[model samples]
Target: MSSAEAAVPQAQWWHSFYGGLQKMGRSLQLPVAVLPAAGILNRLGQPDVFGKDGLGWNNVAKVFAAAGGALLDSSLGLPMLFCIGVAIGMAKKADGSTALAAVVGFLVYYNVLRAFPEACKAPTVLVGNQCIDYASLKAAAATYQNPGVLGGILIGLMSAWLWVRFHRTKLVDWLGFFNGRRLVPMITALVGMLFACLSVWVWPPIGDGMTSFGQWLSDLGSWGSGIFGVANRALLLVGMHQLLNTFLWFQFGEFTKADGSIVHGDIPRFLAGDPTAGQFTSGFFPIMMFALPAAALAIAHSAKPHRRKEIYGLMTSVALTSFVTGVTEPIEYSFAYVVPALFAVHAVLTGVSMAVTWALGVHAGFTFSAGLIDYVINWGLATKPWLIMPIGLCFAVVYYAMFRFIIIKFNLKTPGREDEDEVEDVTKA
Candidate 1:
């Protein structure tokens, strides 16, 4: 067999493994993401959105809420979760070393950034007034209570990559223990600290910029949601969606808390399933869970007679995944690389989904994307959980029918609709 053919099985195996890991990560994110939000909301005096109230109605009845608050205060909530999530998601082997490196990197970054002002401290009498209080210093530097889980994830991924790339190289015999996987965490911590130092000293204003940008997006209202939805998908093509999400979801300047505090970090976390917390994510459910799959169905139904069965099987899987998990890359990449026009249509539909959700004021949040899992968590924890199911089903039917009709009418070259020669060559070769 040719190298390409031989490699296909390996690729498939990797894909399966990665897909499973992604699902696991998504599952973990649901609870971890909610905890911080729940805690914050509890502190702010909001009852459980899930309707857990009773006659007693004591503040301490909020078990999740109390746990969430402790997690946030300890700084072990989102940061630690992000480190583990990113490490496992990106690592080639799912090794413990990768996770260790991620954790170390996050700690390093946190300590470095957290300590810069203290490091710069001179005697208070000489400088005027007492040495800056740590909190005041952090606030002045634009570093809030949370630096953001997204930032932690990025650092974790970077650390894991570094470990993978250089684990085998030997530099010193005396420091053998620090080589390979063992050294990943140390390196991560060092690197993070360095970055933190640089952030506080040379580039403090960057935080302000992030905050301003988030605030600007927030101010745009429904139009902002539509723009975010379109831009998010567009950026995904170039691998910049994470950066955008960080700016919007994290950063104190971007969002104000119910208590009027300038809160840093995710809007969803701040609101904890408030239904109004995840304005950006709310719009996505209709599109990913509904519209994309419908498009896929359209393409599948339009396929040539001989290829119809094969195409249906493929599209069926894609549709289910999109509906349940909100991971559209599998379905999208199938057509996007081959049929640019169809992909464009998909993007337009995404924008429409955002606009529709915004118009209806259906707000919900997720750590990952707008999949069924997130829909359930946000909805269940939200004040109005019942609304999601009915709304979601409606979108699903619309998406499937619309997609099917479009594919048949336009003769789009979706998977099953490939030319006869293409199929023959694929099968024969």
Candidate 2:
């Protein structure tokens, strides 16, 4: 192929990768939406909350706990949800068959992993009266190592792709019953089995590498957190933060609970009550809950006086969204391209927030975004939760002062400062 042609495919590959990640993020919302409710219920059901001995509604609290706990239950919880959601969301069209295929594929895939040692004839160890495949047992015991959420995602993606590719395939006259969508599950089962067999040999080393990488990151401490915060804000410009989240939120870090069950990723570990769980997440509280909103206020104030009224509503809405829901895109995108330097500064400020929070030993986590709702809902689960407030207030002042200075000094076009005609057009629109 010519050089241009080669470049075309390379560019296409990146586009596909980015597009796929976006789809995966959207698809995951199906399952992720349940997390806030689950987290709240789980917390409220704890002995310290509604379940306290002095509380008359201990039984009700237990019920609430069980209800939420069932959804969060590691075994058949998020993994299965991801499978069904991805199968439905990633398909060319949402189809029940695709979901069914994902579930079937996931089951076969998980069992194959679970049975790998015996299937491969790996040596077993005598454990009391039973001969246990200790290696396999060990892998099984570590919940993170088990083909958990990642495996579900893999199977779901494969099943969805297969359904899209073969769901309409025609069969021989006698085999008409297996034609069309019915063929998807059959193919997925075979493919899932092969995938599982391969993963037995392949995934262990990959898992080890990931584990090693997590350890390296952990060793970096606040520096690592600072780097993550910078990268996260930078990646937001491209809407590719989901790729980082797939690893950091779902697969990074390992924590063992008092019951000896292992949980991986910041969100899971934090919900499971791991003391060290929030290093990856706590910093965003200041950035999302306080800093960005303050920055929004600065942008509003910096607008031309004549246009201030027109832009105030927009700014107020986005600022409230950031503070309450931790969605900062509206505010960030307002000036991200208009004044790239300001965005860069914002990214650095985010990194500083992350580093400071980590260094202070402040542990807080969220089911959704780092917003007021999450901060309050997860307060009981956080270590030194009160500290986040003062930290956020400080960040608010810094963000307001810095953003106001930058916008005015550069005459930046942030929201209300648009050209006269453009502002008129926006108003008309």
TM-scores of all predicted structures: 0.69, 0.88
Give the number of the best model, judged by TM-score: 2
Q: What is the lDDT of residue 204 in candidate 2?
A: 80
- Which runs in model 2 stand beyond 4 Å of their true positions? 1-14, 53-59, 117-145, 258-260, 424-429
Q: lDDT of each structure?
A: 0.62, 0.81
Who wins the lDDT comparison? 2
lDDT of 1 at 26: 47
For candidate 1, write residues 346-423 as lDDT tens digits: 676677676767667666665456777666655544534455566666766776776677677777777777777666
